[model samples]
Target: MGKLQLVNIEKSYKTGNSSIKVLKGISLEFRESEFVSILGPSGSGKTTLLNIIGGLDQYDAGDLVINNLSTKHFKDRDWDAYRNRSIGFVFQNYNLISHQSVLQNVEIAMTLSGVSNSERKARAKEALADVGLSDHIHKKPNQLSGGQMQRVAIARALVNNPDIILADEPTGALDSKTSTQVMNILREIAKKRLVIMVTHNEEIANEYSSRIIRFLDGEIQSDSDPIEKKDSASINQPRTTKKRDKTSMSLFTALSLSFKNLLTKKGRTILTSFAGSIGIIGVALVLALSSGLSNQLDVMQSDTLANFPIMIDTNEQFVDFSELGPPGSEKSNSKYEEFPEDTTIYAYDYSESFIMHKNVFTDDFLSYVENIENELPEEVNNISFTRGVGVNLLAEGTDGVVKFETMSQNSMMGGFSGPSMGFSHWYEMPKDHQFILELYDLIGENSRLPEAENEIAIVVDEYNRLSTLFLEKLALTEEEYDVTDFVGKTMLKLLPNDVYYTEAENGLFTPANP
Candidate 1:
């Protein structure tokens, strides 16, 4: 409740080349617990005067004071607080948010004042119960008729526990019976606080008001004290202003009210959410595609360059210690010496190659490598073996047995230290038929590998040279012998004089020395 004072209040509006004065120097004072009716015709400044009194509009030149505090001294923030916390309004149109239910409509004001959910619910229910609309709390405004909607507006005004209630033709749109019901609620409210009602009904002003102030041409025509009017029903109650609670709007309250409003119109809410998120989803998809392309490029590069150069040395137990040229210059073995045609076998292209010291390639080595390859990750496709190797062969020819050697070379890099390690006497190991077939691409004049185990194949010139050497050693005539193909020829595979060991079934080692 507030003790409202208007001191010589004046207001105007501009109309092109002229000014129209609305309120003509009105001065008045009002107290709480008084049902004051402001009576006037259309365009007589009734609503303007009510708006000025409620702090909704400003007077051009006058002092409007509430509770002894002049509004001229109030800032914008202070005025907002006063409007939200101290004043309540009841309008002719009901002014209910259409999609919101009765409970949500009533909860709107207190929700803006930072009241918790539980407390707001309890108080909103109590206010609806007072208006006899408790059963329809979940119904929307369109579900109710004129009188019920007006009652809901009344409940919304009462929900905030405001200090003053300002009504502007609150029952103008309803029938006589509904209007009476709405007026009765205002009368009950005026019993405890001030309610300034703007209406043109003379009978209602005389019957229900404690005082009546009439206006004509924007000035007060008559101020009645209820004792002067016939059938005056003013209550002789002492007026007192209630101290106001200081609470402001909070973010949580704003969000809670927004959610309630959105729930009332779900289709509109969904469209709005999509409108805000489309660009974000597009940006995220673009970033994911960029990362996927980068990973694929990396995988392709690794597959192209994963194979490394390896040197398998059959001898490993004894160190030669014989220095040749320098630490970086290694002696080229005579076994890899140039053939009669001074030819080179093109093997592989690698950036840099390493040397591996191993005893020999045997049946056990193949099984060990197969087990190792299975234990690795699936991306490791060619980890077990790379291509290049040197071949040293001793086989039978047209006359008898002969010895020859071949080597695979890569000359891309130079001036690097070769591996220094121990050596042992040379030894030969058994190999799979598929292993020999792979070498046909390099050494066998585009011919296939040896089809039978007893047969042997070599480079084209090496085959011709070995035939000549064997014929020279046996003193055989070249005209009588066929040296075109060696497919059906026999071969004596000779192993070096060295002791080799195999793992026995009893976990003991068995040695074979040749």
Candidate 2:
């Protein structure tokens, strides 16, 4: 039986949506030691058949047998091992790597086969010397002539010491003299191993190949020497023993090649790095600015809250403005106007300037809030309570005791006290001295918070304006008198509710005796 056998092999290629059969049931056998040339025109499936024999391409149907072992069960790694150890390829273009030296190109195949560095170099030098390229091994492929480049390719193909050498138009790019030289070298190598070549030159094929096979329209037309069919006993020969170490490349070798490839294209490497860094830096700057602005806003909010303390008004009220139109509108409209049958007014008319909604807390709810304030000190600072108490202020004038309707009179201010009025609550001194310290900061040395029950601080508006009636009652002119003059001034009479009134019969009130 022959070393290589193809039994009714078929191959096809998909072009767009149609399948084109390249090899239509090709069957052939090759010997272990012969220079065989496959001769055909372009697209005659000559190269495809050669590729299939070398394990570079797979057949769609039928099987390829190597050393009496079937290739139908061969996986990707199995074909890889076969290509690395048993076959070598030479192309028409002398396909040597442009960036690598001739010697490095020759050693690459053995590198894939896991050969040692020292053995690879020695064998590569020997192969180059065989092809008469020993001195030019250190130069790149572009530095060589066409003949010299083809010699480098031949050296690379032979360096692995493969069982079969598959050459596709090895002389297609060389002159007659160089072609003769290359053919002589291949013929010499064929003395021990098989040499299968595909070429279009019939004259050279007849003179060089030991046997010539001609193809026509994807079919073998003629064979100078063809082997007869083998029996079933020969087909059932024992499978070749699997080798322990399969084909592989070391990590160091792979990285070395990748680094050399990158060095060959310096402009692409730099451009890629610059573009990537610009995107990363842009995202980083946006995140940093957003974080800084959020921190500043938090600090501003805390300072504002400290200056204006949070309060829960016991007499708190609201105005339902749901039906109000946009600001400065003439009238209100119902939001649910589609349901006109519902005759319930839920909000005040926008035409009305003032709307009142009282939300009075019950005694039980007030007790619950006070308990929470005492229990959760960290959550609440403190709670201060004030009643809507009305007071009558009296001062002794050059005449008799005069009565003044002060701002502390809740009944007089109740109509305007709310969010719109700003000064919503009026009360005496708080138990905490922090209120006195704050009053000192606001009014300077001339005024103080009410410490004794008989004294009171004359609080002013944001513009520091005081009521003219109260100023006249205190015997001071608002325009000319200094505020220091009003300090420690005495009033003729201070009549509180307990001193000025008494409960008469039937819950009626009456004046007390002077």
Candidate 3:
């Protein structure tokens, strides 16, 4: 019996409404210590056939017999054993673990086969030495050149002492010079192992194999003697490369080499991974804190507020008096007068209270907003609106009172003023101001107003508190303004009116204006 045989193999895959057949009644036989090359163009089912032979994939219909045993009847464990004992695969990408040393990678196949540690190491070292890579046992796959890495892959394949090696486009990504080196190594291995390689390069296939099988439209077009002789003078002749020591190393030797490299570069590796660890920690912390805070806020707000509470304030005055007023003046009356045409406004219909400015509603902007809305959960209910206004703060200088626009809420009031700091105040007006609107949609029943409007008239209570604490502790002043200001202002406009409009004993603010 031949070392491997595929009798009347057929494979198909369901694509859309039809089945696409890849392999069509392919029959092939490979003997021990034979080098066969399957030459085909892209989409010729060469890789799929190789995968089936390697036990990585199952053929729809076939009789795959290896070493006189029928693989068609093999179970998972049987297939695993067959693959472990009979086949070694090398891919075009040289699937080496970048983090592992050359020796470690080579030893992986034997380790997977449950070979003893000492024997695995010895066999891996011997294979590497055969590939002229004994010295690179401690080097990572990335540290070696392309040709050297492919040699490492060959060494890995040979370490398990498998009877067959299946290489798929082994030299596909290498330069012409490096490709020759890789082919020479494969040619040498085929002298003792059944090396079946799939390649598109006809010249490389002819140079290394005694038999060349051409595949077309997923069928074996021809299986015949190589048109070119192995002795043909080709550019890929084996070169006199530097050879390493033949003495094999123990498993401890390889492990020691890896440990030494890790120790020598511990700081760099640790630093590189530090940022990743920090990122994970930050994400965990944010989720934990946000969830906890949200839960507590939900409970507190739900127990106190009704579905809607009466909002009592001057017409068109949405500013929270608690933040803009003094500590004891939370319930103080504002000096501003109401518009003559003003009437009681209902907060329940506030969803349609403000219209979005046409300037801010560009197609691109709407598209972006729509994309963001799409990512939200489907249970959302209410949406809030906000507007931004530029207001000037009057500060008394040494000579005169100077008016300056408040560029940022965190701006240093001490820089432009004397000992007395100029605080911000919100004035009610009948005229609509051209300002940016920040809207918050109520998604869940437990949703609470943003703290910006909840904490009196503060732009963003939490952020302002944090910024004040930071400035106080560090004794620092603002150097640059950030978008955080806009976010804070936007959130202020999105807060529920009840949070800032009603008395504490009256429960939450109502949607009906009083």
CA lDDT scores, all candidates in order = 0.68, 0.76, 0.65
Error of 2 at 334 (Å): 14
Least lDDT summed over 10 consecutive residues: which range in candidate 3?
429-438
lDDT at 338 for candidate 1?
A: 42
Q: Is candidate 1 or candidate 2 better by lDDT?
A: 2
Error of 1 at 141 (Å): 1.5
Question: What TM-score fits each model?
Answer: 0.50, 0.59, 0.47
Cα lDDT tens digits, model 2, 89-197, are 9899988889889999999879889888899999999999998998998999999998888888888888888888999999998899989988999999889888999
Q: Show the colliding residue pairs in model 2.
A: none
Candidate 2 clashes: the total is 0
Total clashes in model 1, counting residue pairs 3 or more apart in sequence or in different chains: 2
lDDT of 2 at 449: 58
* Best candidate, lDDT: 2
TM-score of 3: 0.47
Stretches of candidate 2 exceeding 4 Å from the true structure: 231-233, 236-244, 265-268, 279-514
Worst 10 residues of 2 by lDDT: 411-420
Give the Cα-based TM-score of candidate 2 against the true structure.
Answer: 0.59
Top candidate (TM-score) = 2
**lDDT for predicted candidate 2 compared with the true structure:** 0.76
